[model samples]
Target: MTYLPLPQPRTTPVRVMTIAGSDSGGGAGIQADMRTFALLGVHGLVAVTAVTVQNSMGVKGFHEIPLDVIAGQIDAVASDIGVQAAKTGMLASSAIIDTVAGAWRQQGLAGAVPLVVDPVCASMHGDPLLHPSALNSLKEQLFPLATVVTPNLDEVRLIVDVEVVDDASQRDAARALHALGPQWVLVKGGHLRTSSRAPDLLFDGTEFREFDAPRIDTGHDHGAGDTLAAAVASALAHGYTVPDAVAFGKRWVTECLRAAYPLGQGHGPVSALFRLNE
Candidate 1:
């Protein structure tokens, strides 16, 4: 016999859902989340909250989708498709946050799904993405339901009601924010001025874990946060603990930033597809 045929086993895909906005540039928001999931070998799903007309320069404008439609999309996915992990981002308004939180509760997927909340309060280009009212709504409606809330310095200020200037301040802010009911809180220090490293602090309602990486000097980075959040979710979906997820996620984003390709005239995007050859 020249050869024999053998049956190959099928592998189940890791399911991940991202509830966020759509970036017209295809560099951030829903697109970035989906891309990150794909790069990490996970099946991606999305429930868009808004549509933004933005580019590397900045956000020109945005339109929030109807709350009902947002709810329908979330429920439709959670009910049928199902997900191993879920992430929330760019909640354009209080209404959207309220709707998503309500769905999570009513659908009883609260503790079942590993929820990562990337509290995207505003864009790095000084464009206000979330309204003032949405801040209160986020705390009341979404914070309590999150498995982990990832907030940058600016966002941590809003969430914890304190200014984060350094690592110590980040620890304090993390503790205060954890009081709001998130199982764990991660304070991203990318906005802080440091020598040559980007540091992120994670407070797991107990001890603090600091994640550090040699900063990649590049302005062509837009979807970095979304990528980090998605990568963390993917790791968690694969049964990695929170600390391990953060460590691996940071390494992943560092590589992404290091391999970023210039796109527009202004701020570009991190390379989510950098590991393709590997």
Candidate 2:
């Protein structure tokens, strides 16, 4: 009997990297990023900048990884695995942020690969993730190199030094962030209580677009922002435009939130594998 040859895989999986913290709870940061990447059909690489002793209740403590190690991780991934796109989250300190920025430039990933900056300043429980002193460095060193910057309402306030109380103020914040040099800015209005719709504003210097979803009235969305930012990077790696990627990310996060389940004692996490269960 003659045996037929097996089919070979033709396309290489898109590789995307996450330079962020590791959540011991497996909800956000590197865990969330890797989950999102896999769900979106991309290979996920991680350059852990910090490790958090966090649970669904809150972040108890964190340890920032050394700058050299952080740089080495990025170098290893970019030199060999080769990142198609990347995202930054929970960069703990100014030193790590600086190291990451330097590595990005040194590895020639600035314009070669799309970078999504999730300026994660605080946790869902209002615990500060980034040091106060590191804010300036993050905006100065990383924002300019970012292809897109994704900030929630609280993060927008922290980065732009303005209160986003209304739709007009949200627009102002997006424009202000765009001035910092990211090609695009996504101002997530998930925390807006007055509005029935969760309106997220996207601005690209010249034009503004809005993406809205019905607010999921659940408190189980612990890692929603990280998941959304990771999804955007994954979409970018899969060859979607910035606007389209953001839209896709928003939709995916909405699904995750809608399918969220109870985890620990407090705020739980959105289900990254919700699509699989469905």
Candidate 3:
């Protein structure tokens, strides 16, 4: 007897998109994000803004993608397949940031999508990834659209001119940055005030949620920020609440860093697929 037709898939996979650069080091940027999404059971898409020549040690060189090309990439993914959640990282220039912000505005993705903005200025190995001129555009254009802005202590100073090295400073910095318009702001305190513990402050306009973890003393964290931001976006795309998503994201990054493998001569990358083996 002939078999009946098979049923179609019940639902589309949660789609998370990363608009960032390509790191040849395979640690940070879009590559890390994709891996995070995959490990989290979400679909990952990318619109790379630049090509970075980097290793664990430091960045050697970077080539910016043309503004038109960036725009085209955004349009192609956003129009056809579409994205449920997305994040921005390593937009090399003001023009590139302007282009992406304009595209998002034009696409009217403001409230329709959950957006994470990881203002990636400097690399982990003390290399600058974003141009100084682009900082203004990021604050004026992109910050307002972000559902969550994940900035390390240094990046917080770069954006809002506020110090976030201590608990008190982190609170004030979160408030000041929330004023700039992100619905939620997370000031990561893993680097600064690095004494014994790692504390992160998440300010949701009205309240503050602090997450602390015992700092894993290791240099094998190449894509910690990218991985965290991407994991948050992935969780949000899968319909998790902001607080829960951030918590899970933080835990995920910690585990990745803990299980990081020694690769190149410098700091290696956090394993985005840690959950897969768990």
Q: Estimate each model's TM-score.
A: 0.95, 0.95, 0.94
**lDDT (0 to 1) per candidate:** 0.86, 0.90, 0.87
Superposed Cα RMSD, model 2: 5.0
Question: By lDDT, highest first, what's the ranking?
Answer: 2, 3, 1
Q: 84-156 in candidate 1: lDDT tens per residue?
A: 8999999978888999999888878898889999999889897989998888889988999999999988888
Candidate 3 residues 2-102, lDDT tens each? 11122246856778889999999899999999888777767788888999998878899999999999989888889999889999889989999999999
Query: How many residue pairs of model 1 clash at the backbone?
Result: 1
Winner by lDDT: 2
Q: In model 1, state the lDDT of residue 246.
A: 81
Clashing pairs in 2: none
Q: In candidate 1, what residue range of length 10 has the lowest lDDT sum?
A: 1-10
Measured with C-alpha atoms, the lDDT of residue 248 in candidate 2 is 88
Q: Predictions ranked by TM-score, top down?
A: 2, 1, 3
Q: Runs in model 1 with CA error above 4 Å?
A: 1-10
